[model samples]
Target: MDEQQLSAAQLAEAGLDDWRQILGRLKARFRTGDPATGFALANAIGQAAAAANHYPDLTLTGADVVVTVSSPDGPGITRRDADLAGEISRLAARLGATPDAGGLTQLELGLDTAAGTRLGPYYAALLGGEVTDGEPVDRSGQVPTVWWQDPSEDNDGPALPAQPFEQRWHFDVWVGHDEGERRLSAVLNAGGRLVSDAAAPAYWVVEDADGNRSCICTPTGR
Candidate 1:
């Protein structure tokens, strides 16, 4: 099977249970400013589940907690991983949490969406990001991920998260120097700030509008 196609045991390792509890703890601990970001994140979770056609276990937190990407369904960053991370990125956008690129604290970037619609307006509305102005859009991921249904058309799943931030591992996004600048520009425009920068040819640390940090570098730099 592909990297995302995992056996039942692999799915089990992703923590199907207590998803809300984890999210809640994260929210309580981090106290991200925007509370609605949690719901936006919830909607994003539903969106990803819809797209992947697979549901991730979540801990209930009265509409304040949900599962994140990072929980791998397979070994290595497979197609599924990219897809999942993309979903989270798109969803986090809605909550004002874009990719940090540098100083990453969590890396949830693998999911496999065997089914679901790639062009979903609801997801766009939730994310507040337009669909690239018609570029023959496929799935909206720089990576491969899955969703159970499209958030725009989805009316099912764990509902929205009650708050922002969650328990998970951080991830770093690698890119070329030019791409790094572009990403940083977008992040800056989105309300993300530059957290750190390396002396290398192409390396930077950025925080999303929500304050999550991640690294950015060229592909070769990776």
Candidate 2:
């Protein structure tokens, strides 16, 4: 049987307070305070996942462990993911680890192009990923997803005239709602200028001194 996909509201109602939906996956970080504790937490999560027949990707560091849960059958969150996330949270608490939801972030690449159907396959081949709905998704989750956007289409920001030899690629940094302002401030302080904020609380477009653009995005108002 296919797994039932869960929406952001459903996840919140399910009591997965520690996890946040990033892109299409549920991500959370646990501060273990030390390498030993972090390893212990990772191991515990592994065992629990095995027992439950659902696994999550774990990144262990000297002071923390980042966990990402995604349904293997598809790209969205499901009940299995929520159950595994709850179990992981319980394990973290038992191991004296603290959940850091504010620190969770996801990065994605966007290319402005009117020919999404044509460019999607090229990007997918270049990134060794697969094309889905005019976006290239990295199956390994190591590389950021590359999405094609049509400049002529009505989007969040004002549409610009398609020009040749202009920069059309940008980065989308997805952060938690509470972390949006702080991150945007950091970018601005680093000499980045605001390009647009019409999508405030949803996203803010900013460009560096060299005109390289990126977006500070939040789940709010999305």
Candidate 3:
């Protein structure tokens, strides 16, 4: 990692209690209680970002404001992100806003394929994003990232033959480690079945009754 790039541990040590590192971005939600307050905070955040020459993606809902910050020129969190997180927290505090850490989550799309390199460009173009390190990433954060799982790369063996009826795509829903089990339980209660838990604390594969699958993921193992 570069000296400027911050790891998860460094981000925690920075005393940013209101923020969480999700999907390589520093994300946080502030409860504004009403649309008026949400807009005010959004405007304040915009001004702060403009002054620092670093912008964060801001979403203002009817009762909350979601802020996601990342280094524009890099792929991971950096010192500037931590600084801005602190400033945003302070601003929210002054406005009597409360941080809702539990509301943060990130969704990513995963494709199981033998020809990742060949199919990457097609998905990237369709999603209006670019392929970075074998994954399609939407810089605007408007769409979930698309990653590939190439079975052939597992043990230097030949690529496995594609099955006509196999499920080729799935979703990887990332949440805080502490929130993993609750999410899994919710899925089960909603008619989803546990497909696998061999990777507990990191991820668990769950499938809907019809067989569509999604993995509830956390940062614990990877």
Candidate 4:
């Protein structure tokens, strides 16, 4: 086992039923009855993070407090995050908070660029995001994360050179397996083109009329 990172199976064993691990982060939502309660929980979470020396992407709005934890230098959840999550869960229990499992959704940008090392900083600066491991992410948990991909070896084959963002940057809409098809049809109805379904039930490559791409993905049946 890596000393810095914890695998998905280990995260599960750490009693993190309230949290969901996806896209190299462990995300969980705590539902409060009111805004005041929400803010209180968020504050407590901040204190907990400080104590653990591991901060989460904590967001509080209306009646929900969303927390995302991960190691800055490791893949997915780490031992530090799992321990912090345990602390947060205990604090949440004391505050009468309940888990909001369905409130989580993650977005990632797939940019086909050979010069990922060069373009990453530009997009990170442009989007007010931070670059980590050559990927740009919204560390505040407010915006979709952007990651670069080499289109030279994708299932879609070689990518074409483009004048602008079209055909290069696309979205990866992470959804539950149960909701994948519904979302796919909705996008198609919204005038998005089906680029490829060769990897269906796992991911479906989609494109807009202008050639921008997005994939509808599910967690199961992969």
Candidate with top TM-score is 3
Off by over 4 Å in 2: 1-8, 73-76, 156-165
| Model 1: lDDT to the true structure | 0.42
lDDT top scorer: 2
lDDT of 3 by residue, 1-222 (tens): 332998778877999988876767788999999998898899889989999888899988899999998887766889888898899999999888899887589998888888888998898899999999877778787888888887566633223333346787899998875778989999999999888787777888888888787788887766
Locate the minimum summed-lDDT window of 10 residues in model 3.
155-164
lDDT of 4 by residue, 132-192 (tens): 8887776666678787777565544334334355466678988644456777788899999
Clashing residue pairs in all predictions, respectively, total 61, 0, 0, 0
The lDDT of each candidate is 0.42, 0.84, 0.83, 0.76
How are the candidates ranked when ordered by TM-score, highest leading? 3, 2, 4, 1
Displacement of the residue 24 alpha carbon in candidate 3, Å: 1.7
Candidate 1 lDDT over 81-173, as tens digits, reads 445544554555556643322321222231123222354344444544444432122233333221232234544322332325642223455
Better by TM-score, candidate 3 or 2: 3
Report the Cα RMSD per candidate.
20.9, 3.0, 3.7, 4.4
For candidate 2, what is the total of clashing residue pairs? Answer: 0
Ranking by lDDT: 2, 3, 4, 1
Name model 1 segments beyond 4 Å from true: 1-32, 55-74, 101-222
lDDT of 4 at 217: 73
TM-score, per-candidate, Cα-based: 0.28, 0.84, 0.86, 0.73
Q: On a 0 to 1 TM-score scale, where does candidate 1 land against the true structure? A: 0.28
